[model samples]
Target chain A: GDSVTQTEGLVTVTEGLPVKLNCTYQTTYLTIAFFWYVQYLNEAPQVLLKSSTDNKRTEHQGFHATLHKSSSSFHLQKSSAQLSDSALYYCALMAGNTGKLIFGLGTTLQVQP
Target chain B: ETAVFQTPNYHVTQVGNEVSFNCKQTLGHDTMYWYKQDSKKLLKIMFSYNNKQLIVNETVPRRFSPQSSDKAHLNLRIKSVEPEDSAVYLCASSFYEQYFGPGTRLTVL
Candidate 1:
């Protein structure tokens, strides 16, 4: 069985400050991919970043994450937070041959001005 | 613009009532999925259909059934809804990456 764990329930930071949302996962299969999804108010979750290569930093929309296989971690980070970054972030692991994505309980990030 | 579409942005029903949610995608993707998001915003996959064929069925209740008429449409039917059935149902279609639709919020009274 594969599972994703997000330690933060809620993270608040002032705009223009650095931010990090912790994500770690466990899987039986070696060939697995990790994804980060962001859901805004009243909107569906969208793919923020995805990675399968170990230690490769994937970046999108000013957000970056590096998948570390040794640590089983793919932490999303932003150099500077924007007010628009307030949303629910989910860490998901895609495993098995069925294309099932196991998602972690989301972390709500609120960027305050 | 939304590539995937879901009808009835909101639904309200009583316990023991039957409910169905509709989902369609225009992305021409071969696989479609149904995910449930609870109040705590935990997104869980319930069902997945690839090319109108059931590929993955999670540990969901027997009351839950997924219907797919074609590759683009996949609907969910609940035979007897319970209070704990209240949540947001999201439909998604995937090629390499999954794209989700605005979910249907279900409230079982």
Candidate 2:
């Protein structure tokens, strides 16, 4: 069984501050791909970033995440958080082309101005 | 900017009733998935159809069934819905990445 564990339920940050949403996973599969998805209110969760290459940092929309297989982590980070960045963040795992995602409970990011 | 469309944004039905939620994707994707978001906001995979074939059936209950008529459409039918079935059902398409619909909210009384 594959599983993903996120930092916590709620993460509040002041606007323009650095943010990091921790994510770590456990899987029996050898090759693993990880994803970070953001879901706004009443909206579908959209892929924010993804990576499979271990130790390589993947960046998108001013966010970056590195898949560290040795550490079993793919923590999402942003240098400067915006108010609009308030949303639910999910970390998911996939092995090969199965397309079946094992997701974490999700972390609600609330950036206050 | 929705590539996926789910019919009946909201539905309220009594227990033991039957309900269907339709999903269509115009993204020209080969895979479509049904996900259940519980009241606690924990999203779980229910079913997945790839190229109109059933591929992944996560430990979903037998009461819930998924049918795909074509590559673009996947519908969920719940026979004799129960109170525990109340949740937001989401339809998604996978083209390397997943594109999701707004989701259908199902409430069982």
Candidate 3:
């Protein structure tokens, strides 16, 4: 079984501040892949970052996340949050042969200027 | 830069009617998937197809079916739609990372 949990429902941050969106996953398969997707209003979810190798960091669009197998987490981080960075973020896992994604409930980020 | 395309960007239909949505992928990938996003903005996997074989989500109702004529086309059909079925349906393709279509917004009244 594979599942993802992003415990934050909403996060409001001031511009230029640091931001983190917590993501933790549970998987029976040892070989698992993690992904972070960003979905803006009226648009489909787009892949922001992904990583399969544990302990390695993956980054895109000024956001970075490290897959730490020891902690079973791949929390997303941004050093300087911008207003345009506001969107709903989802953490997903690809664990089995089906290639089906197990997605988190999502966390909404609101960046204030 | 888009690899997937979905038809019927927006649809409003009666609760008891049947509706079909089309999805096509040009990424040359063997796997395609359909996901549902509810009004709450929660995403859930609905169906998947690989090399023309259907893999449906166990929780999906029998009334919801997937039809694939070729490796690149996956169409979704919903029979006797319910108000709860109103949501955004996204089509995606996977080649290590999944690429998504713009999505089709369905409104069941």
Candidate 4:
């Protein structure tokens, strides 16, 4: 019954503008870790950031995300969006030690120049 | 830097046909997973193998099965493919964070 939700299916932003992709999850397990994965067109999805500690920010490749247990969210954010940042982003949750990932319906980011 | 590998970048088969996909990871990870990415790019876990043992089996159809010969190799087979099975199959291996393969795109016509 665990699930992840990405509210936006597509987010368009101008280059050099701030952007945020919302991610929220509901899980029955106690131990959990959240991940933000980015996939370019015709490429494999790669980890952008991962965090298990609640309220701690995890960042990679100019993108950052903070896991908030109180809100049950781990939203990915970037201060200045670039043309190269246009890609499909996925939010995933790993519950317990099972190694199974519950992924959200991905959000496609289109940064216009 | 791509440690996970999957065979057959693309596949096209008729409905009811059988198909198999091969996946290998050079990361030496004990946990390997198979995920289905639908046309909407929604990802769902299908199966997971840990050290050659079946750990997670999602509520998928019986035609779908996972084969693991070793910790590094995990294969997926569909006995009778359906039209709805047309999607991208992603192979991943993980210790803490998952590393995904290029994925095998399946088109069942």
Model 4 stretches astray by more than 4 angstroms = none
- Scoring only the A-chain of each prediction against the true A-chain gives TM-scores of 0.97, 0.97, 0.97, 0.99
Model 1 chain B: worst 10 consecutive residues (lDDT sum): B36-45
Better of 2 and 4 by DockQ: 4
Query: Per-candidate DockQ versus the true complex?
Result: 0.89, 0.88, 0.87, 0.89
Clash pairs detected, candidate 4: none
Native contacts present in candidate 2, fraction: 0.89
- Please tell me which model should have the higher lDDT, number 2 or number 4: 4
Higher-lDDT candidate of 1 and 4: 4
Q: Candidate 2 lDDT, tens digit per residue, B1-109?
A: 9889999999999999999999999999999999999998999999999999999998988999999999999999999999999999999999777888999999999
Tens digits of per-residue lDDT for model 4 on B35-64? 999898988889989999998898999999
lDDT of 3 by residue, B1-109 (tens): 7779999999999989999999999989898899999998899989888879876565888889989999899999999899999999999988778989999999999
Record all residue pairs in model 3 with backbone atoms less than 3 Å apart, i.e. clashing: none
TM-score of 4: 0.97
In each prediction, how many residue pairs overlap at the backbone (N, C-alpha, C within less than 3 A)? 0, 0, 0, 0
The Cα local distance difference test for each model comes to 0.94, 0.94, 0.92, 0.95
What range of 10 consecutive residues in model 1 chain A has the weakest lDDT sum? A93-102
Better of 3 and 4 by DockQ: 4
